[model samples]
Target: MLNELFTLKGKRALITGSSRGIGRAIAMLYAEAGAHVIIHGSKPSAKLDEALAEARALGASAEAVSADIGDINAVKGLIQAVGDVDILVLNASMQHYQTVPDFDPETFALDVNANLRSCFLLLQGFLPGMQQRRFGRIISIGSVNQWRPGARLAIYASTKAAQFNLVLNCARAYAADGITANSISPGVIDTDRNAEALADPAIVEKLRSLVPARRFGSAMDCAGAALLLASPAGAYINGADIAIDGGMKL
Candidate 1:
């Protein structure tokens, strides 16, 4: 019964930015749990193909998709390609570290488009289907930065803060329809995207010291949380931000 509660049999899941890192981990896990997973990447690449192949090898139905979620037209195209998905994981984001004075307006706009606008559009495109079916799971990948902003992360933090609020609002608006929206905030996860930042001994030590866990997290950590939230076990959990940051915010 416990395993059955977490099963995703016959469900379809769309996970963005899934070519690598946390997104990849979630896609793999979802497939293993029985969802037909759609692995999304920014563009067509060998990485996306490999992820699809690997999921199939694990005895899961999977496919690869590509789109620039930052663009409205592209997002529409992506929705058309995906049709309707039972679970939507908004994991694509852009991060530019620049102080307010040094930040470029165009870059800030780009970040907003990617982080906020895309989320809004995807929800709009997918919400109707979910409402009709009376079931949905929307998970946004957030950050600890929303609560603790470091140097030069103004735009990124703002976008993430907005994401959290959006999840709450979505939950309130759709709870009656059996839809749940939530955010998973991760701290310094050891992914290739952060390889350069973690390479410096001083930086690594500084970040590790701040974490109660005293170590960087893994992509699988985020994936584990995602699995619970996207499964039947998490149906009653709505409008909450689950911080998988090794208690960094604490």
Candidate 2:
């Protein structure tokens, strides 16, 4: 029974933003753990095809899909195209940073629509299927800025904070149906998304200095925790916004 709790044998999992970075890491890891992984991203590309082949090589049934989560119609189509899944890992996110002194409202709004609204729309399309099944795992990738707001990203941080609450709210209502919803809050992960932040040598040093662990985080680092939370091992876990930040929030 204990082993079963962590076992993902015969499960099917859908992961968004899986073409690269954290999303891809989670999808590949899920495949390694015995779940058939379905990868979702913007559109078809050679990179996506490569990732799909890698999963198949690992002996998991995998498919590459494309959709714009920000569009309700596209989200519905994505769901309809995939049919159903036992797990949903929402790892796609949009972020922009600028000193408040020069920030523009239009771009801020775009960040909100992309980072936050997309999740809501996707959930609306996918939640019903999970609720009916009474067994599902939903994991959303969040950011530590939601808890620790700072300069250069106030608007982005606000949207992230809201995402945290949205996840908890959904968990509260959906846990009864055996769907465990949680958020994995990454710290300063070294991904394409944060390329600019890392390009500044001083900025990298300063941020690294702030973390108690004193090291940069990678997608694999977050994946280690995500695997556990995404499996039956985490059935009892709901409404948890766990920070995978190496004590950065602490």
Candidate 3:
């Protein structure tokens, strides 16, 4: 029964920005649990192709899509291409590391478009089908910055906070429809995105000291929570924000 609770057999999942990192980990795990997985990237790349191939190698039906989610037109095309899915993972985001005063309008707009607007657009496009099916799971990959706002992550953190609010709204409005919307806020993780920063021992030590866990998180750490939220195990959980931060928020 526990296995059954976690199983995603017959479910179709579309995970955005799945070429690598936490998104790829979730995609791979979903495929292993019997879901037909759709992995996406902003554009075609070897990483995207490799993720797709690896997912298929797990004996699950898998495919890849590419779109710059920051562009409304591209997001529309992505929606048309994906059609309908049981699970939608909003994992793609754009982060700009600039002080609030020094931030440029163009970069701010791009970040908002990709991080917040794209989530709204995707939810709007996919919710109808989910409502009709009476089953849907929406998981927005947020950041710990939502709580521990970084000095240079003003815009990124603001968008993530807004995104979680959107999740709460959807969860409240769609609970009766058998749809669940949640967010996962990950703390410092050892992914390619942090490779450069973490490469510096001083920076790594400083960040590590901040987390009670005293260690960096892995993509798989986030993936485990994502699986729980995506499968039957989390059927009754809604409007929840799970922090995969290892007590960093505290």
Candidate 4:
């Protein structure tokens, strides 16, 4: 029963920004769990190819696609390429580290387009099939910043907060249709995006001190929550935000 609950056998999943980091971790896990995976990146790269090969090696049917999620045309093409998926992971996002006062308008728009608008567009394109099938899992990769705003993450945090709200709205509206919408908020994960900052001892120590766990999280730390949310075990869970942030929000 436990095995059945966590299994993703026969599910088709499309995971965006899956060439590396947290997205890649989730894609790999999903593939291992028996899902036909679709890996996506902003553009074709060795990392994307590697992720595709790795997923296929896991004995899961997998394919790769590339698109700038911030662009409507590209997103449309991505939607056309992917067709329909039982699981849609909205993990692609743009983060700019600048204070509110210093934020450039263009940068802010790009962040909004990538992080918030893209989620909406993907949902628009895919939710109908989910509603029809009456079995869909929408997992949006959020951030701890949605709860505890960071000093330099004003725009990024705001978009994430708004994105979570969108998830909640979907959860409420789609529960009867067998669709679950949830967000996972990960804190200070040791991904490539944070490599430069984590390389400095002082910065790493300062960040670690804030977490009660007193350590940084790994990309795999977030993947387990994603697996639960995407599988039968989390069927009853909806309109929820699971924080993988080792008490950082506290």
Q: Best lDDT goes to which candidate? A: 3
| CA lDDT of every candidate | 0.93, 0.84, 0.96, 0.95
Clashing residue pairs in candidate 4 are none
Query: For candidate 4, which ten residues in a row score worst on lDDT?
Result: 1-10
Ranking by lDDT: 3, 4, 1, 2
Instruction: Give the per-residue lDDT of model 3 (tens digit) for 1-250.
Output: 9889999999999999999999999999999999999999999999999999999999999999999999999999999999999999999999988889988899999999999999999999999999999999999999999989998899999999999999999999998999999999999999998899899999899899999999999999999999999998899999999999889998
Query: Each prediction's Cα RMSD?
Result: 0.8, 1.7, 0.6, 0.7
Q: Write the per-residue lDDT of candidate 2 for residues 14-123, one digit (tens) a residue.
A: 88989888998888888888888999887788778888998899998888998877666777788889888888888877766676777777887678877788888777
The lDDT of model 3 is: 0.96
Candidate 1 positional error at 142, Å: 0.3
Q: Scored by Cα lDDT, where does model 2 land? A: 0.84
Pairs of residues clashing in candidate 1: none
- Candidates ranked, most accurate by TM-score first: 3, 4, 1, 2
TM-scores for every predicted model: 0.98, 0.93, 0.99, 0.99
- Ranked by TM-score, the better of candidates 2 and 3 is 3
Q: Which stretches of candidate 1 lie over 4 Å from their true place?
A: none
